[model samples]
Target: MVNWQFWKRRTPARILRLRPRGELSDAVRVEFPELAPDVRTYLGQAAYLQLGYFETLTRLIRATPDLAEKEALSLAAGAALRKHLALLAEIREEDADPAELMEPFREPLDAFRRATVGARPRETMLTVHITAGLLDDFYLALASGYGERGRRVARILRADNDRRQLAELLTETIRGDEEWRALLSLWARRLVGDTLLVARGALLLDGDGRGEAARAVEPVFTALMAAHARRMDALGLAS
Candidate 1:
């Protein structure tokens, strides 16, 4: 078995590095417990991630020879860029430099991209599909932490990502060959560990919280897995 706990091999890193620049509000404290990152942490990580997705899909476009595949990837890339810009706008409204806010996360998030990106184009395509879906939902779930600002972030995350085309590309390829099916299924299984680790790392957990409080993460974890299974099923790949 490929150890899904692969993030263990890397130096430990924190994804949410800042205290809340403003109120995270009391609502999330009551609702999500210790899981809410501050508004800036939320904004910076969310924006940078979409930018990373845009860049990855754009690179895939250059490497892909087929015009139709290139076009499909372009739509997904463009969608990610739109979300990135929208997040930058939100950062500016808060009177923070978008570049500065995003700077701290550059190393860790880029490392995440390197870890999740694949050796083959098909595998890379699947990487974007699975990771984006999981993280998008994860962030969306966490959005309510910042009150109204969080709501706006939620709206941006909810926008059409045009990732379905990426899915179509993967599904067509997987159906044609058992080898691709097996390879992608295995790759996807490996990805879930790293992807979930990124989500878990971003959360604000107590220093020694345990038992039921630690297990509070279980529901969010389960929700992420359910959504992941649905995506794998869409590609006819085992979760």
Candidate 2:
């Protein structure tokens, strides 16, 4: 049996590792000269997280027992992986080391995977979809502060259709089953909380010298929570 509790307890320490190291490298500075240093760092960190999200989706697809559901997840995962790679390629074009750029985010991503290792298939799907929505909002917010290249990158990262499919599936699954509705509601809330915790930590990490960046990210957080509540309502779950 998987020890899910152990993974959850270990997540916070991993989240702490996400704090900004401060100061952009010369390569990154040159690569995104039009953008602020904090914006560059935020974009880099968001890209790393996007890569990790796809990796986690792949794992979830493999763990799923239902062939139909697995296929759906596989399609989403493929799309997500392609988008992540494209974003990374763009970064590489800037002469930055993709590996070094993503290295700091590995631990927190790994911790998230471990924490949700034994979740039910539906739970995993819901978490993935919700997380993607939150990320899309975050990227959009940051993209607005950058140049055309940043806007294009953020646009490519949005998985709106995929997230909608998953959300519909989740809604269908929980409908008319009181126990399942209750259980999934709690699970969704928990996942939302965990995601927000990491997000807050990430924002605070960048807050030291980038107070405006932190303030700019606040609306994304609010929008995510509001969207989550609407999703829960759609599923007949308590918000």
Candidate 3:
């Protein structure tokens, strides 16, 4: 049986390897409708992603010295955990086992988590902010394709992530140091590749779906990129 509580471990488990998914370099046009994950894959991956974010933020909260910053990180971590539990409730309502649904997605998504883990506290903090922002936007967009259940999910995803304070903290750091500015600017940009990989991985898009994929992916990702720019601009970092 797969351990549903993989989140409790400090190190990621060595799960079964996943089939290769597209990298950012693939220019993977989403070609939605055809590309969206089925309901099970969607809910499973979405819930697990929130749990990953919560875990990462909670670690940051434990390591930081500043009380005020700890409070801010707690807010983001709390928000992520709430979303995870709520999504689990949603899965139960449909008579599906949440862990079973989430199992198939573990390896790839966990790999994505490891790639985004930053060496420094500040860099990790920014990682949570930037990656969370992008994936939430992408999931909310994908929710539209699911129906009434999807509508319910859109509402949950729309909830205040309580992350504004976190972003404010990062923005202050970026404005104060030119070196931090350059390093984090590049770090934030590099995060996009791994992020988009997980986002695309959550979808049902496969070789069979390739013929019309490009046309469908454009609108959702275009909006995602625009939101991403606003986030960077707000941080006074170039996107």
What Cα-based lDDT does every candidate model obtain?
0.78, 0.58, 0.75
With a 3 Å backbone cut-off (N, CA, C), the pairs that clash in candidate 1 are: none
Instruction: Residues 18-96, candidate 3: write the lDDT tens digits.
Output: 1111111233333334455566667888998899999899999889999999999999999999999989988998899
- Model 1, 1-239: lDDT tens digits are 22222222233222211112111212222234555556776788899999999999999999999999999999999999999999999999999999998987788888889988999999999999999988887887777556778779888988899987789989999999999999999999998888887887776444543556447766666666776787788789989
Q: Select the stronger candidate by lDDT from 2 and 3.
A: 3
TM-score for each of the candidates = 0.86, 0.72, 0.84
Q: Rank the candidates by lDDT, best first.
A: 1, 3, 2
Residue pair clashes in candidate 2: none
Which pairs of residues have clashing backbones in candidate 3?
30-217, 31-213, 31-216, 31-217
Better of 1 and 2 by TM-score: 1
Index of the highest-TM-score prediction: 1
Per residue, candidate 2 scores C-alpha lDDT tens digits across 178-209 of 77777887777777666665555444333242
